[model samples]
Target: MEAESGKHIQKAEGTKLEQSSFEPSALSFQLKIGFDGKRAANNLTGLGNYSRSLIEHLAHQFPENQYLVYSPKVKSSKQIDAFFKLKNIELKLPLNGRFLWRSLNILKDLSRDEVKIYHGLSHEIPFAIQHTRIKSVVTIHDLIFLRFPRYFKYIDRKLYLLKSRYACKHANKIIAISEKTKADIVEFYKIDPDKIQVIYQSCDDSFKMPFNKETLSRIRATYKLPEKYILNVGTIEERKNLKLIVQALKEVNEAYKLVVIGKQTKYFKTVEKEIEKLGLKNRILFLKNIPFSDLPGIYQMASVFAYPSFYEGFGIPIIEALYSNVPVVAATGSCLEEAGGPDSLYVSPTDSTGLAAAINQILSSEQQQARMKKKGLEFVQKFNNPLVTQQLMDSYKALLNTANY
Candidate 1:
């Protein structure tokens, strides 16, 4: 790959001019970014996925910017095919190292390399090194436990709020993943709106419908997915409201099977038991730990993509479903309203009957389904990575101008 001329890269003559250039060679300023690698090593859930994807994008977009991804385990097999694009971005995985050591010693390491900024991709900044002179920015994905504490178990909920409070109080700038989350931060933490920047997360471009017949057939056989199944992607949890979806699927026409693609948790035994009682053994299929590459085929082959989660900072799979031109049925709560709009077939998350009726209506009406395919394609356009990535780059420019970072 030819190195993009730092001067001409931004001046390329295309609508998606921003994406054409990926140059890490002319790095003018160094950035040392720390992550919750200890937490990341355990389970890569919402915040972990958010941290990994955005940092990958940043590393690609500003190749000239020295990118150091500081993780707890310095060495391990956490290779992301998504990051195959950012070959130059250094991964400083300090595996088996104490979290305290990385949190405290990271800045000194950055200083030795003369790195200008230290960004914490997670909410918890280094509490031990807050007063350091290095420029700092923290990404607060969401204050979920702060707003919906009851959704979390006691001990996990307690620790999150306390750590978030400290990070918000001290970090030079805060990156809020959604506008709804920024509002929560402003209200709960009482931070200035100016201090909090809304950086919408982008759907990984790999989640597009693939054309390879051999690959599609292999994935289909492996998952045992029907050619015409309703798809739901995301972890099985209470907030995901999988129980209602399972219940609603029972009422849908017997021809349309329900296929769920994600990991099931112990708390979601309620959903698992409901599936058993309903005798949906053949009607419903659950494929956990589905590979990222295979997901686009899952979305493309679905009769309709349903996500009835009660809350979200931003719904990535909704956008993924839309891009695949799969008709979407998203919940009418929280960020879904902002994320899906008319592109999705919407119903209140509160009413299971309402959800069931909507599903029946979509499944029954071919005309309505046709309209949704077009609407979803239109809705997904705004979420195209080049646009969102440029917005993120603008945020980086703003942070640079802030004089604080």
Candidate 2:
């Protein structure tokens, strides 16, 4: 949130090399950026990952600007200890400690702090602050509610549409995670294409580093993880299509089990019913609520990672699997290709036979697995921390340069 006398900054429309770099040490301008920290505080899901990673990188890579992260209540500061170590970033708690200050009172605080840029990490921006001088940016991760209406309750779907549409209409610029998301924004909300910028997200750096044998063995013993399994990590919901993977596993004649790591929803009952009907109890395993620190080991130990999600803004787990040196077999549709890369196997979303064939093909051959692993590692290099951090900083700089303060 650098305060400069400018009329307006337009959307960024250049490659990484084309943009001018802002020197972090010299800090030519004074920018104070405020972010909606609600998701970053209590959640460990995708939203939380996006918020925490972006904020941490901004503070680390661009130390010149000040950052304010506003949240209702922070579960524990220790979870994000690396972020707190940075002097330029501060987390502000709600005054009452009992209410979500975002809708009610966060605006007054932002105005008082004289924040120049307010970013809504989730699909929301404060309505009270929209007309003010503060320039706004909103990140819309996905339009899942709109894409799969039956998955969401009526009230939740309506609210998501309302908030997402309002934010898109009012924000100075929108950050879409992928081209698919950008297209959906334009189609669903009728927003101008020029107003949106697509920025791909990277998984945490921890995923890239190799885990030691002792730690892996401890986690496996603690969780009772199988030696060989097809890993799938995502929420257990209809749109995620976890049941399809289970169905496909039945046809594959291998000792490798299907290990799922995600929170279970009511829709999990549907999957459970299928599992019981098939009596494939020993073949399918669900590991819910595993510690985030242990996820890399889980991914590394898997025989092959399978993601049959119907759609996603960008699939972080696929990238995580790539970094872990695990071969991937994902669904064909949507942005999974961007995450899985060309070397990995792809099958139709609904075709169990196709999925089974792909899984079997990878498991049967050691040379194929090695080649895919090598290619996946090479392909995922673009999503490394330095590249993604630069892209994000460029977007922030572009927004600030084009806005009137």
Candidate 3:
């Protein structure tokens, strides 16, 4: 009986496809969506995490819709392959060519697949898709290249402006990860504010779960973690403002230490110079190549999490700290307030003295620590996967309902 029902449904779907070829009005039915999965397939950073989380949550929440995940070059990664295990998702690769396909030929594949909607999980959409029947959405994570142009090379900044402007102007709807990013899109591109939607991203569920004492013990021993420390996670770069944290440490109690976990770059040398000049070699530790699975325990064990970045689209580490029941101290110049919530303390990005005071307050007062932890855990509940998934589905429905598609 199940097999018979499946056959009937397949036949009905075939009929719908035939009708949609000639009439886009047929889009009122179940959606066939295409996603630019380049970051999810290749990166392990913010963009990749956003892509994976969105695909996983969307597929779980709305299994009736068909999803095609396309990449410039389809390679097998354990992270990407896990998403393919979902019966509703298919891995689509470039059919025409390589470099040119990103800029030119992906539109042909979208047409061939008969996708009603295409979403660029990163900051780009194929230029040709705007002229076709497919409605498109682009997620612009940040306009950092424009905001912090000093950090970007000349050619990189120009290309970023060109592609981001094209996507903002041409796509059916835009998803900005935070209100800061949405405002930047309007200010930099001179695009209408009504065209953008602000959506929040959260840390993985691993941070929310309780860590086993044995696992925590193992991680502590492996890293030789100090009993009391402030933790910061991100690349050791100037923009992340690790130097501010190091300077703050000098003013704090001698028992407290700072542990940072990220890959070292040339910027680390500059950071090292500051640390040495301040005679803080014993007070700071930089952990390299830590396994992803161990991050939760690391967060849980910290006395406080410090995120002193000068700017960001959103600070994922702040939410991670909240979920791990650790209090947070973050810089004030960007979207850190949104990520840190009301319970977390904020200080100027450049004020090492203010940062020191904030960290001292958390470290000294047990009552303050407990109150911040409770409020933060409650705040992060709004970003749970189920809620975020429903919000995304609503956007998809809204885009498809528009008369333009």
Off by over 4 Å in 3: 1-29
> Candidate 2 residues 1-405, lDDT tens each?
111111111122321122125443455437889999878766667788779788877777777787788876655434554444455667776555435478757777788778989999999998866678888899999998898888789999999998899999999889998888999999999999999998888888889999999999998999889878999999998888988998998888668898899989988999999888888898888999887889999999999999999988889999999999999999987889988889999999999999999999999999999999999999999888878889877887887788744
The estimated TM-scores of all candidates read 0.85, 0.89, 0.91
The global Cα lDDT (0 to 1) of model 3 is 0.82
lDDT by residue for model 3 (90-149), tens: 666665556777666888888887899999988899987889998999999899999999
Q: How close is candidate 1 to the true structure, as a TM-score?
A: 0.85
TM-score of 2: 0.89
Arranged by TM-score, best first:
3, 2, 1
Model 1, 244: alpha-carbon shift in Å?
A: 0.5
Model 1, residue 317: displacement in angstroms? 1.8
Give the distance in Å from residue 96's predicted Cα in candidate 3 to where it truly belongs.
2.5
Candidate 2: stretches off by over 4 Å: 1-29, 80-82, 95-100
Candidate 1 structure lDDT: 0.69
- TM-score winner: 3
